[model samples]
Target: MSSAPAFRKFHLMRQRWSQLLFAHWPIDPALLRPYLPARLELDLFEGQAWLGVVPFTMSHIRPLGLPAVPGLNRLHELNVRTYARLDGVPGVWFLSLDATQPLGVWAARTLFHLPYLHARISLTQTGDTLRATAERTHRGAAPATFVASWTPGDVLPPAQPGSLQHFLTERYILYTAGANLQQAVRGTALWRGRLFHAPWALRQAMLTEWDSTLVESHGLPTPTGPPLLYAADALDVWVQELRRI
Candidate 1:
């Protein structure tokens, strides 16, 4: 019998507003330093349903978007988003705005339609490698499942012909129930290729539409393809290696 609760929650609060505003910021340590949260928590879920919470904060006047939202002209803002998982799947997310300000509770209940947060995770360990299966569900319906396979290896190494890229994972796929969605974005990326690549500014501008084409081909409705979900920051190189688990 499974005794674990069904959901994990993380509450993100903001101290200083982040300057970057555009969505889908690549996972970069330096660029994300300004917005990195100070503290957060993860709670255990139990029973027919499960709940978890994490608390963190952000800054005002983020660099990437519209002007900061001001309420009572306070220097800091406090809020929390709860995650709830049911049936071992991603369930719902509820956001509580203005925890520190007056009427914050009323605003959270009336203005936004925040739902309970949830997610289902399964892990398998094979020798030195681990495989994680993450599923997202809405109501009783499952949205998508992301399977990640990881193992300890060098960050950057030379690429050989017909070899897999080491900087990225073996593969990332989406699934629904037991059926493969077939709507998966698969590609081989080598960050450290000895190729003439543009600087960050030029690369960002030129590769803006790369995601759109890549994801759309896989039956996804992404106006822009999903951004590169890098695991580490400022990783400018790729390696090629595959070891048995």
Candidate 2:
């Protein structure tokens, strides 16, 4: 019998969900280097996957005239010194949405990686949910769309690194479900500004354990083709455990 896939503990580093849709564009590698952390690391596979992380840090403060409430600054922000990585394949790019800004445009043109990026993000409003969608063009010809909706939780628990769904959900909720998977993920300008979404308000609740090397997925085929399919049906299904890793 085969062993089940173990999910790693998740880090509740972010909360708000911001989705992006990219249509046709090219990215430059050199342009990305400057934005990455000095001590960053990367592992690349031809036109397929690239995994790496750069250091990151961000602060929040209202502009001179903006309101100074506890959480009200999603207009202008800044992301500093953050590290991120990705494992992108044909349709798998649909699963990664980690950063606030759409940094994938530069990667596609330069690395020929995750040629297209797309997705949507849901926010919390008076305990209800508010969603926003964004993206950029990559493939130079193809069009793609990514979407997700989430409810707001007052307390986003730290994901157990070994909990694939938990960790991944936290990751997507915090990082990769909106942009180019192959692109380097970074802190967004929103962090330095406001906390318009639940994801942004939960950044300080991170607790990391040992780095995990386990990856698992619950993927489904698409009606359009193999390149376009739904990963799962439940948008609100709380991750239980991976049937396989």
Candidate 3:
């Protein structure tokens, strides 16, 4: 895996993430190019591209000087994403980020310059299993839904560099091109946000149930093969303010 940027002395946001499920499907690079800005190249491995559907929950979300409000602090999130590079700086490029909180959605979109949408989502834990259900409910946005139940298995060591797992899950920066994904096709403002977090304490996750329409919502075909799945329990994170790229 790669290292993060120099740690920021101050961060605009602090949040804790839990029950993260990372599901990736390999796809043709050409299929994703049109969704990103022409200036950004698809970050590929072994001449292949990947699409990821990640489901997780966020807690204690707060801006630098503020207290976390009770009604707006906790939410479930699901994102459709891919990897990309701008001048060789690799980072995540999201197609859509669906969250259960409307105010959080608006705040993210307005302040971060990222695509964030409202959705109906729930994530529950029973014993060692996690069950999640999500449906995009944003008005006029592309419809999507996800259902999954998985149990974390044996813990794995940190991913080594050049490995598929490393390439897919070890990202620390994110690139955003526009307020929405559709606006990026023709070119728009491009920004980068740096995140600082320790290496994921990853584990193999056994899927007992899985179904999703996130990729198809973007006009991509359903992945023909089963997704590669990995899980992480919790991590504290810091997000720097977005900077023009």
Best by TM-score: 3
Cα TM-score per model: 0.22, 0.27, 0.95
lDDT, candidate 1, 170-221, per-residue tens = 2111111111111111212101101111111111111111211211222333
Best lDDT among the predictions, by candidate number: 3
lDDT per model vs. reference: 0.24, 0.24, 0.89
Evaluate model 2: give its TM-score.
Answer: 0.27
Summed over model 1, clashes come to 43
For all predictions, the C-alpha RMSD in Å is 22.3, 16.5, 2.8
- Model 1 ranges with Cα > 4 A deviation: 1-116, 140-142, 156-245
Cα error of candidate 2 at position 196, Å: 22
Q: Model 1 residue 83 lDDT?
A: 27
* Per-residue lDDT over 1-245 for candidate 2, one digit per residue giving the tens place of the 0 to 100 score: 02212321321112221321111111233433443323232212232222221111122322323443453323211111112343331111222222233433343223332222322222222333323232323243233333323333343344454432232222321222213322333432111111122121121111111121111111211212111101111111112211110
Candidate 2 stretches with Cα past 4 Å from truth are 1-104, 107-127, 139-141, 146-149, 154-156, 165-220, 223-245
